[model samples]
Target: MISHTAAITIYTKTGERREMAEATPYEEQRRRQVEANKRKLEELQLHHLSAAIREAAAAAKPSLVKKRKARVPLDVADAVMEPVRRSGRLANLPDKPVYREKVPDFGMKIRRTYGSVRRDLTNRVYATDDARSYAISKAEDLEQELDSSFPIFIKPMTQSHVTGGFWLGLPIHFCRKYLPKRDEMITLVDEDDDESDTLYLAMKRGLSAGWRGFAVQQKLVDGDCLVFQLIEQTKFKVYITRASSYYESED
Candidate 1:
């Protein structure tokens, strides 16, 4: 007796023809579920709803794109130049004048004035030989006692100093260092504790006006020497050394 059985044909890469059989029960169930989902979507019209949403989104999208602004040209007639700002590092102040020491030039001739006449002091004599020697020794002894701790200057009496103009010019360096820079009345204290007011001429750097009174009161002559010690501002302790000629003339 002959029996019939369901079987599938197979194919090989060697050019043999083949037939595939229907899927198994499990695979068939999965295929039916997929077909059921498709039918549900069709009934609900989900594809048409999605198409409408896409159309609405496209309509709502902004149509204008952002662009850079165009440059505007300026007319020459309307253009204006701005003033330059100065540097902040520069101080807003007047220029300071340079300070220089007033000094006489070299090889320049200096003339001493005695009232109306100009005199040459080159061959001038201060005192006799013995009198000058005594004054020098006394000054040396006094300087040794002070030891330069105080400011001191010596002025030998001249015709211009004791008579005529009666103007006494102190050493330039000493005036610059120890004296006032303006016209003022300075006190002169003698060895007897007597104080005399004398005028300090800042411009000429000399003593004027009242100096004649001090010279006359002290009996100062053309050969006497006076030592000025600055004891205070605008005050001097004056020490005098009279010449031998003065004593002779007095006798």
Candidate 2:
């Protein structure tokens, strides 16, 4: 969690001049929930795997009672679930939620920030680091805008967006005006300031779930959703809301 003063430092460094902002309490609570959920999912997976192995051994004559997981191929664990993701396999395929964790809900509000035992997830992220670097080398403009902006609102994504999936493309601009270096950490924060904000770099490492990835996120209330707006090219805005905004199109 960031102190209010720290939040301001990030802003002033970027070029925001004394604009007061704070992330809401709701944002911080949800962010913590998501993190806790990810950690617990790993624990559950270990238990699930252990139970299965134990059951297999208990069989009177265990001869390949279980098809060896080797058939699943060897994989490195990542922070966000992929491969075995319980949901949203279509949009972010190949890379899927390794484990599907639960976003707990109670009635109309969140029963808890992050839920339990929905699925398992990997602790290590894959391939995304390279992807971010490639994206950054390709687009500099988007980086600058985001760097200067500091904390912008984000729409919490659903299982459909794919696990470990956040944003894609946008215009390129040199970021020296805001970020000291193109690859330097770019901070994204909520104007409300409850400390749910995250610092990220568009190109360098980009943003995703992993030790080196962005930790900032927004968790939705029971009915709310996040919308992705492509600011330019692949640089998009992940906006949060109760539901999608519907405006009549010009006939």
Candidate 3:
């Protein structure tokens, strides 16, 4: 049996009291439960890894068998039956079926824009330092010449390796002139602005005039600089040029 004791000790002229307690059964049980949970989680991870290995082995068996069957035998004749053997291997290879789809060829399209700017106009701003001023000037010029609220995508020109050279500011007007019947909504791909910035400020600075600003790290080609206004979401594609290439058919 354990015995309980109470004592008062004084280290100096002032009196001080101290107490020490033994662990209770409830505390011990809680500690054991926490340890058990940790072990259970480790076991679950091991089980998941084992399952993944088994699934991979099951998927690879058929592919291995097909490759083995396609392997050429060493006993075959070299000169007498060379064309037949080559044709046989070609026949066994997988066929790539072509499907027709109408894809746009926006040669040098300006898709989006990204950057940051200060909130006030009274604040002295320089063209080199102020992103908002640059965007506004570009937008105003495009609007006056094009006569439409064409979608202008905005992005940063800092630290970003622009593969395509800067936009010549003609594609936006051209798209507006040609694709006039489509919806024109400006989308700002603001790489510099965080979620806290107001939509009004972004629009006033000639950035995409809307609340729906998305961030995308586009893979751009070298010597390419995009500048244009999109007519609709369907007309725009994220990383379209880098994703695929087209082959022309002989007429």
Candidate 4:
């Protein structure tokens, strides 16, 4: 009885497995279809053909080397922050030259010519205060004694006119009005009636040449005043007022 029951249990489990298999016909059919396709691929030798194509493509292609990975931005950040380096050749160049201007020397020449009309070693003379005052008074007296019809011009003498540079510059207005426009010989008649010939330079507006002799003979000095009365076109009647101490001494 135990053997029969054990047999019965085995038979029952076999029957349930058979029934489950029969119920899933679609799964069994799909599995059989996949097996049949694999058999067909094997019969056509398609698996071997695919493997040959892969090998042929690999053999035709060039070999590739593995590329190194790119560096991160932070890895080269210090190098980017550093300043640019200068060329080594620039350090050997010479420095640029500086230029300076030379100063002039004029002290010696100025000392020799200062206050000199003729630029000679002779001492320069100026009129005394008393002599200038006396000459002006004497000039007014001489102007009144001259003829009223004739035009008169007065001049006060200086060292350049009477001594060192005997060059006399006449009044510009007088030369423009009464004197000739061209240079000519003019006569100077002193109070003694002695006549002297002098060149009147229209350009210079002064007496030249014969004037030195007239100035010497008149004994004219600095601060002396002279009155010139134009009597004719080229003739002048001259009167002198001396600045001598003799006149003051006499008074």
Candidate 5:
């Protein structure tokens, strides 16, 4: 025993339908307020996130510091980069020294005594040693060879000649000469053969006295030799190969 109810239908003439319910003014305003509140919250979150990122970057960044330079000593300033001398080497300098020499004085007197003939006697010397060793040694081979070595018993006379087995002469040719002007020593140099028998004289020292002094000392005016034989007055022959003791000189 239930009864059925039917809804009321309103039909337009052209057959259009109307809404069943409509929105209220309060609902529209509430929806708009909700949307605005959502937008303000999103903006606030973004601003907070940006502020946090800036703070983190500032804390992580490095700070800058100032630097200082090292100092050098003033005493050794000039010694730097200067060239130094090597080992065992010397350097250039000044104030050196110098040197010199000396001289001496001469002492002695030489002169001619006898037995110098016509010959060149410049700057030469002689002695009994000057007599050639071979010539006197080869006496057997020499012409006019005496039976033995003989000395001449000289006689002061008007003429000079050879006597019987005796030879005589004024023998003033055996001495040397000294030139005072040139200060040169003139020595005896023998340049003759047996036919001439020219004598030359030379010596480191000179006659202490003249030939007359020598003749008196050696008794040459009388006779002195290796062999002796008096044939007559001022006429004698003797072997005369002997050292010259009659002549003395200074060293």
Candidate 6:
């Protein structure tokens, strides 16, 4: 025969009740089971998160392609003439009129003669200011008395006594008096216009005569009757021997 023990109950002045039974082994086992289930659920969630991360990485692949861009020459004539076109001063003048030409023999002869003649004629003519005034007066007198149709060349004397360096300052009216027709005015191709057609001929002549940088300075005039400086030095000299040939030429 087994007897079940009953717990004693005590009541204090305050009404409160307390459970006297301790936890059974079954209850403790149930609590441990609940905790274990929660742990397994957390592990499963971690596995799913890792799988999703791997799938996302596989979907995002890198590309291996490149992108490329295309490259044009310049017009030389247009570039060169553009500046001249923009300048208002050259607008009225015909572009073709500025064409280059070969220097004529007559023009070259004048330039070569000018330097030597000035030295010979005016070397001792002016010493003091009074003498220079007198010489100028004489030049004016000669200019006035000379025939209008005569070809005249005038140049300023250099302060230095160089042999062949005379300043060409002849007035244009003086040149026109002799060469009235515009067509009669001669032009020369020189070192300045080496690439032009006229220059090609000039170069051939210069080479045949063993010269370099030869040029012909020609006279020009305006409507105002002003004489232009008719002579200029060329980069090449034909030597006195070659110059003699030029002098003999009729043109």
Write model 5 residue lDDT over 45-141, tens digit each, in one string. Answer: 9778999999999999776665556655666755564445564444443224334211112233323233222223252223343232322333223
Off by over 4 Å in 2: 1-164, 167-170, 174-177, 197-199, 202-205, 209-217, 220-243, 247-251
Global Cα lDDT for candidate 6: 0.36
Model 3 spans with C-alpha error above 4 angstroms: 1-118, 128-172, 177-183, 186-208, 211-251
Ranked by TM-score from best down, the candidates are: 4, 1, 2, 6, 3, 5
Q: Best by lDDT, which number?
A: 4
Model 1 spans with C-alpha error above 4 angstroms? 1-126, 245-251
TM-score of each: 0.46, 0.23, 0.18, 0.49, 0.14, 0.22
Pick by TM-score: which candidate is best? 4
lDDT of each residue in 1-251, candidate 1, tens digit only: 73233457887899798876657677788889999999999999999999999999999988788777865455643465433447655445434555743333333322222123433446454666667666656665665666376799887777788765778998999999989898777788999998877777888899875677787677676767788899899899998876764446546
Residue 60 displacement in candidate 3 (angstroms): 99
Instruction: Report the backbone clash tally of model 4.
Output: 0
lDDT of candidate 4 at residue 189, scale 0 to 100? 95
Question: How does each model score on lDDT?
Answer: 0.72, 0.38, 0.37, 0.74, 0.33, 0.36
Name the candidate, 1 or 5, with the larger lDDT value.
Answer: 1
lDDT of 3: 0.37
Clashes of each: 0, 34, 18, 0, 20, 14
**lDDT: which is higher, 3 or 6?**
3
Assess the local accuracy of residue 15 in candidate 4 as a C-alpha lDDT between 0 and 100.
70
Cα RMSD (angstroms) for every candidate in the order listed? 20.8, 46.0, 31.1, 27.3, 35.1, 19.3
lDDT of 3 by residue, 182-213 (tens): 32333333223222111212112222222211
- How many clashes does the backbone of model 3 have? 18
- Greater TM-score among 2 and 3 belongs to 2
